[model samples]
Target: MNRKNLTHKAGRDNAEPVGGGGRIRPVNNPREATKTRPAGGKDAKSTGIDRTRNFCIIAHIDHGKSTLADRLLDLTDAVPERERMEQILDSMDIERERGITIKAQAVRLVYRREENGDGGEAEYMLNLIDTPGHVDFSYEVSRAIAACEGALLVVDASQGIQAQTLANLYLAMEQDLEIIPVLNKIDLPVADVEAVTEELVELLGVDESEILKISAKTGQGVPEVLDAVVDRVPAPESAVEQTRGLVFDSHYDAYRGVISLVRLFDGELAKGDRVQAMGSEEEFEVLEVGCYSPKPTALPKLGVGEVGYIIAGLKDIEALRVGDTVTKVEDPAESVLPGYAKVLPTVYSGIYPTVGDDFERLRDALQKLQLNDASLFFEPENSRMGFGFRCGFLGLLHMEIIQERLEREFDLDLIASSPSVKYEVVLQGGETVEVTNPSDLPEVFEEIREPMVRATVICPKEYVGQVMGLCHEKRGVSVGMEYISTKRVQLTYDLPLGEIITDFFDALKSRTRGYASYDYDPKGYVASDLVKVEILVSGDPVDALSFIVHRDKAYYRGRAMVEKLKELIPRQQFEVPVQASIGKRIIARETVRAYRKDVIAKCYGGDITRKKKLLEQQKAGKKRMKQVGNVEIPQEAFLAAIRI
Candidate 1:
């Protein structure tokens, strides 16, 4: 399987039909131009559920999941040669620009098994799901895995196993999915195939022979991997009881409305059928249904064990939530599918429009974005930055994606406040409340408890001391440590989620020279000596600029904050005193000198009395202006200073 012979550089040649499970017909056009199949062509499958295979690719960030998916598509001839593009599944501009999969994309591939001394060749339908490799999108990965019966555990041959690789594998194991170990990038110059093979065997407890080696870049050994998927991974089990489909992912289309990526568990979904969402109890007529032929190709119906999409003309994105079950309206299933746990937002921030009048537009954009993103949570908020939405996200990357989408897709100029973690505050009145916005925090509290995360960092043994020191400086407690391999050590710590949400990951990457991988799970809230550090601009306390910090780091944080604010806030008519305080006590202060001019310059060479009188008048004017003039902080200044 050489890359040179795969397809033309300009893609002018028409793709040849592949001989597989079913007849592979050439569409010779984009998905939009392809016509719908006949009445029973999709639903009338001669094969049973035992012949179908559904699985996803799981790996660490940049471990080549998308590339491997491209090779599989090529092997199965799922995508046409003329229109084949790099990262076909990662359709979003942001996803391609960042070189990361933000959403899980599903595509159906047909593989024809060569008959061993038999008259006819048998074909198998392989529904391969491509998932994101970043920890921020782990929830998306989980939902995709739920729709699969097995997974291809991909590991980088050069980097060996990483934190997220193991994390994703554990998730698949939790779902009881059959696992197939694969070593990718075998063609790279620095690839150590044998060493990575041993690591996979030790970490996954799989036999060494089970590991398949391939170079997703050159399409080497990809067919063997596909064959292994058909041989090793078991087929999906059928349920004859009733109609049930798991809504793993979805997106909006202006013409078609909401198109949900679903996996049919029991019966079938067809066009013109009435379907109901078990969670929201919303019902709509199925406008269309089909599998992704690299695009939405309309089908008559999707049968059991099949993975495809359903369009129900849903205008309200909130009507169909991810992880909800969709069943027939008249004869619905008695119980819902074992849906996944809802993903909660771990980081919080304020998203405001720079121009005050764009508030409603921002609100509308967020509402539309939230239609596809289930983990994003938001509500209306009033602050110094004007009326905006206080939104929550999975992590820093997730926050960044939402911000970028709002700006790019909606053409919005947004002000994103610094990311903060949820804090548990216990008031003197015996009320415990979880606060995401620092401005929403009450004045008096009996105790302030901050969320903690159990973080696991895997790195080379030589960097253990540096990693441990970094964690300790962040106020982390060493929970556990062990050697994953002779040169690799896994270190676990309990640290404040606030600390982890900051520069911890970047620092870890730097200290380990990009060899360290890290992951964390929330460990709930713990009592801490924490207090709100307020920032006062020109003798006025700005609630939006306040932040909660541990008492031990209070002075350092307050000083750093005041210094940053000094650099950000411009000089006013009067000397604006920037102060950081805990309650009424000011801990740090900085000043922005007033812009002054020579008001007495024109009175030169005049009488001494005249000059003195002019000076007196100028001083009086200055005093009066200082008493009445208000400090006007620029939008940029607010964006810079309030992030602290």
Candidate 2:
């Protein structure tokens, strides 16, 4: 259909018929329809399986995945003009402000195709999943890819391909999903469409003509993208006969309980039906069934090959997981579907509420957030800072986003410990244990193994030397290097994950002038001379300030920590010494001078004997105070030490 003629009029009767005589009835007011829609009666007819297309958009950060989604919605008239906005699918405030997609979002669009000479016009159902581009949220992309049959591989025409582009491409290829190459941001003044097309041709092994060049910002050639999806992408195929659906995503609703977004593989699910989560083995009566046309619109039932949401009044947050399988309780599937692999957090930290009384509130907030973010892992623990939770995150960005959400959404002030990686400790008894917190490290260990990752750095050839220098400083070992194009190069190295988790990305960006793109995969652990450095204030070791570092660099890191602590700790009535030690050996030390009370000031003109007597008495009092006085460490000191 022509782009100009693709508009959907609200409340219009006798709408055009889709394939198999299904009508394309567009709901003008979704909120009203949701409230008035009946349960299990006069349900909307399902479009034929042959006319349904399920696909997701995958790209590097800021490569315009969300922009392209907006254009598609505009072309299909899926969103009302008054309510339309840029990055509409990014529902979170943090996402819109940062211009990134943290969570994967799914929306259903209805498109009407033009009639050919021999065939009549037909309406097609397009299900589009917009996925995040950052490496930390790659798990979300993987789950989205599993639910779709095709992916739109978006590339920036001016920047060509990037590290994440290859990473996401490999993910889609693993699922054997059909990939449609598209070059975005072609309207830029310096956009080298030909060069990028050549890069795409070499990487995808597709002809130059196969790549679609369009400017998502201006809505140029967006309608053609929809046509390509309908013509090139295949329909979903279900092998199972019994009812089965994949719960690709879910979130906790305070009013409705846990609402799950699922892709139906076989059979149908209707409101009031009893469904069971294969993973949790929990059954609940379905309270509602609907689809997201940018907004929740209630439907009577969801059919095979259809994507929609299910509200079963699941009060237990753990009852429905993101990668679980949902099936009818009465006629359940013989077996559970192949769910996604469990993602383990790579970075660890201690998240403690600023107010100790908010511990339960923090726990409740985390439980609700975990319901939405399956990758977040946490457990209760006690440290010198009092009761807190040791949380695990995918990466530093993921950690920042979660902490930010907790503060904004739950109104809780929190302090996060320095990010650390899991380490393997082998004891003298020939036993090994995992250590995520430095304070948990044993007093004596035979050896320590630190986690490592295989990192990929893509940049211009001129900056290759700077990138390599930065990597080498982080203890990286070069694996290989090659030229992806005449002007761009790709560098591969193996570096410790602990090193990359702290300031590595920022250093790389500064060294490359923000032209480098980085991605990494875990390569397990390797034996290293690791030592746990303990920070002591006034002869007392602060467990919260301890950290693990390589033996060779322990002295320098310890010195830096003590120096920073000296500047942060407040002056006390008695001398306070800050020291960094490894076991019994002291590596670094700094002192915060005590506040002196001039006893001699009162006897300025007195005899020498009287001044001496006053001085002796003052010295004796100071010694006594030093013996019994307690030094209070401020919160700023802890934050500074962790950052250092």
Candidate 1 per-residue C-alpha lDDT over 316-421 given as tens digits, one digit per residue, 9 for 90 to 100:
8889977788999989988777655656788888988989999999988887787678678899998877889999898888888999999999999987776788
RMSD for each of the candidates: 9.9, 9.9
lDDT of 2 by residue, 1-644 (tens): 12122222111112221100111011111112122322222323443666788999999998999999999999999999999998999999999888899999999999997768656778998999999999889878887887787899999998889888887876776565788999999999989998888888777777777789999999998888998899888776655557888888898888989999998877689999999988899999999999999899999998877899999888888889887888999999887766766677899999888789999999999999998888899999898777889999989999989999999999998888777899999999989999999999998889999999878889989999999999998999998887888889988899999888878888888998888988887777999989999999999988778889998889998999899888888898888899999999999999999899887887767579998998899788878988898887776776676556
Off by more than 4 A, model 1: 1-48, 117-120, 600-644
At residue 420, candidate 2 shows an lDDT of 87
RMSD of 2: 9.9
Angstrom error of the Cα, residue 49, model 2: value is 2.1
**Candidate-wise lDDT, in order:** 0.79, 0.83
Model 1 whole-model lDDT (C-alpha atoms): 0.79
